[model samples]
Target: MPSSAAWLMALLLNLMLAISTVFIGSCLSESPSKVRLVGGAHRCEGRVEVERNGQWGTVCDDGWDLNDVAVVCRELSCGAAIKARSGSSYKPPAPQEQKVLIRDFNCRGMEDTLSQCEQDGHVYNCPHTKDAGAQCEKSPSKVQLVGGAHRCEGRVEVERNGQWGTVCDDGWDLNDVAVVCRELSCGAAIKARSGTSYKPPAPEEQKVLIRDFNCKGMEDTLSQCEQDGHVYNCQHTEDAGAQCENPDIDSPFIPENVRLVDGPGRCQGRVEVLHQLEWSSVCKAGWNLQASKVACRQLGCGRALLTHACCNKTTQGKGPIWASQMSCAGQEANLRDCPFRSLEKNCTHDEDAWVECEDPFELKLVGGDNPCSGRLEVLHQGTWGSVCDDGWGEKEDQVVCKQLGCGKPLVPSSKARKSYGPGAGRVWLDDVVCSGEEQSLESCRHRFWGYHDCTHKEDVAVICSESIPRL
Candidate 1:
C-alpha cells in the first residue's frame, strides 16, 4: 500500500540498523585473554578480559572505584592504595573463561595488583588487551638475624615460595652486601667476598635462587628490588653472607675509690678514691674536719664538718689498702679533701682508712634499745661524724627507729655519747632532712650511711615491730 519510494527508504533504514547492531556486537566480543598486574597489589593498573574468540582481548576499567582497589590492596598486604588504571600491560585472559572486567575498582595506590581492586566487569573500548605479555620478574628474598660465634655476628638465609634458600657468592659485591647490613641495622658492610667462611648449607635445602642481583648499594632489603634468574652452585662455602658487631656497654662506678673510716658497724663512713679507672682505699693520715667537709662536698653531700679515725681493728677487716690513724682540719670534708702538710707515717694497714661528711644527717643507725635510738653516723672525707639529737624529737626519732624499724626512740642525744663499739668503713648518706612530718624513720632520709654507732656489748641492733614477714 505504501509508495515505491517510501518502501525503498524503509528497507535502507532497516539494513543500516542491522549493520550497526552487528558492528557493536563484534566490538563487544573483542575481550582479552591474558592481563598483567602492575605496581604490585597496592596500585593496580591494568586491563582484564572482556571477550575472547580464540584470541584474548581486554576491556576498559571505566567502572573501577576506590572501594574496589581497597579490597585488592588489603588482600595483598602491599601497603595502602595509591592509583588504579584501566589499561592492559599484558594479554588479557580468554573471554570464555571467568574474567574480571573492572566491575568495581577502588585504589589508594597501596595495592600491588589490579586483581586486588574490588572490580566487577570490563569496560568496553579498553585498549589494554593489545599489550598482553608477561615476564617472570624476580622478587627479593627474606633475611633474618641470628646469633653467631663471636659477639653477635651471623649468616643470612633467603626464603622464597615458603621455601628457605641461599645465594651463590659468584658475583657478590658491596652493593649486595649493603642491603644485608641495612636490613639488620648492623654497621657498614666490610666485605663481599666469595668462598666459604661459613658452615656448609644444610641438606634438603634449596640452593640460592638468585645469581645476578643488581643492587644500588642503598636498598634496606634485597627483597625490595628486582633480580635475575635463580642462582645455584653457591654452596655453604661459596654462598654470599654477612657479619655484624655489637654496641659498647657503659660502666663508670666501681669499688677501688673508697676508704673506710670510724663509725658504728663494720661498714661505716669510709673514704675511697676513684683512681686508675678504679676505686682504691686511702691510708688514714691528715684526716680532719676540714678535709672531711671537702670530701663531702666533692661527693655532693653539702659540707664535710666531721672526722673519724679508728684503726683497721675497729672495722671488720682492712680492705684493699690500709693505713693507721688519720688527721684533718675541720675545713675539709674528707681526708682526700684536706691539703696534706705531710703524709702520716707509722700507720698500720689496720688504721689506714678514715671518713668525712658535711652534715651528720647523711648517716644513721637502725635497731637498738629505743625506736629512735640506734648507732649510725656519716663519713666526711675520711672522718666519721655523728647526728645531733637536736629536735631529737619524736618525728626525727621516728625516722631512725622506723629505718631500723626496730622500736620507738626512747632517748635522743645531740652529742656522740652512746659509746657504741668501734665502727667500720665510711658511710655515705645521700640526703637526710627530717621535717618531722615523715611517716617512717627511713622516709626522712634519702638513704642511710654505711656506718652506725654500736659497741661490742650492745652492738646496735633492731627488733622488728612484727615478726619476719614472708616475702
Candidate 2:
C-alpha cells in the first residue's frame, strides 16, 4: 500500500533482524567453557576445576561418583576414569582461592561435556575440601616387571608418556618390592634384588622413571606409593628387581645355596656356599662389610653388624676356600649378584669370611668405663633412648649382660645407679619385668614403646662382669 522505496526499506530491515537472530543462536551453541584437573601427581589426575566467565572454580563433591568422573575424563580426552576421589584426599591446592562453580553434577556418563550434565550451578556454601577429583587410566601410566625366569621375577619398569623405563635401586627394599608384586598379581616378594641379578640390565638408552619409592607395602598400585619421579641419578646396572612367589611353581623361590656355619646362630657364622653338592668357605680376599651385607640379606638375616672382626673370633671351617674375590656395592639382594674375580691360591680356611648380622637386641652400654657396664640404652626407631627402672631387678640385669655377650651381672641394679649418670632423651621402655631366662631385654615384658610414667632420672643402669666376649 506504500510506495516502492518504502516497501524495499521495510523488507531489508526484516532480513537484517532475522540474520542477527541466527548469528546469536550459533554463537550460543559454541560455548567457550573449559575444564581441567588441578594439583595432581600427573596431568590426568587431581581436583576437577571448570572455567566460567573467565573465572576458574572447582566442582563440589556432592553426589560425585565414577559416573560423573567418567564424563569428565572423556570430555578432557583422558582414557578412562579409574578413581573418583573426594574430600581431603583430592583437595585442591589453595582451594580457598578458587570459587565453587558447579555443584551436584548428575552425569549420565553419555554427555560429551560436564556442562551438558544435569548440574546445580547455583552453589551456596560447599566446602572446598569436598572438591571432586578423578584418576584416569590415561594410557601412559603402567607398570611391568621384566627379564626374570618367569613373569613374577624380574627388573622393575614403569611406563610414562608412551615410553617404558626402569626404577632406580637406591633404597630399594622389601617394602617397595612387595608393592610391585601385589600390583602384578605376584605373591609376596622373596627379595628386592638390584643390579643385573635376575637377567641382563635394561638397555642404556632406557630412562629411569622413578628415582626412589617409599611404599608402606599395602598399596593397590604403584601410583598410590610415594615416589620421586624427577631427578634420576641411576645407571642401567642399578635397576631394581624382585623375586615373587609364583603360583605356577610348587614352592616359593628362596636363596638356598648359601648358608652360615660354625657360629652362635644361623645369622652369625662363616660364609659358605654349596656348589656341586660340596660346601666351600668364601676366601678373605676382597671380603668386606659391603659383601657381608648382601650375604646377610640373602640368608634372611638382618643387616651385617660385624664382618671382618667376627671372622677372627668365630670357629674356622674345614673345607676348600673359594678362589673368588667378592666385589659388592652392598645393595644387591643376593650375594651371588656381586661381582667375583679369581683370587690367589694362598688363602686358607682360618682366614675365611665371617659375619654377624645384627640380632633382635640392639642394646648398648653408654657412658661406661667398659663396654659391659653403664647407663642402659636401646635403639628404637633409629633413636637411642633410656629404659625406665620402675621394675628393674637382678633378673633384668642378667638378661642384659648375657645379651651383650657379658658373662653375668656383677652389681645389683639398686647399687649400680650411683656409678652411671641419668640418660638424656626419650624414655623408650618403662615398668620393666624381665624373666632372667629371656635372651634379650626386648623379649621381656615392658610398657608399650615410648609409654612411661618415669622421667630420665629413673633411667636404669647395669654393671656386667669384665669377661665381655665379642658381640
Which candidate comes out best when scored by TM-score?
A: 2
Q: Give the CA lDDT, 0 to 100, for residue 24 in model 2.
A: 82
How far residue 447's Cα lies from its native spot in candidate 2, in Å, is 12
lDDT of 1 by residue, 1-471 (tens): 999999999999999999999878755653332232432221123333222343223434454545444444333222344544434442222223223344334545454444433343544444434322222212334564322332223445566654445566666677877777655435567666442454333223335666666789867567765576665555556556665532110112211224334455222476655433344455556345554554664445554444554554555234454332334344422233222333446554555446644333333444444333345654455675444332233455455555545455454333223544434444333323454545443334333343223223322322224233322
Cα lDDT tens digits for candidate 2, 313-379: 3478777766667667786555544555667667877678788896544888877777898899988
What ranges in model 2 sit over 4 Å off? 1-269, 273-290, 296-328, 332-374, 378-384, 388-396, 402-422, 426-458, 463-471
TM-score of each: 0.24, 0.29
Ten consecutive residues with minimal summed lDDT in candidate 2?
A: 247-256
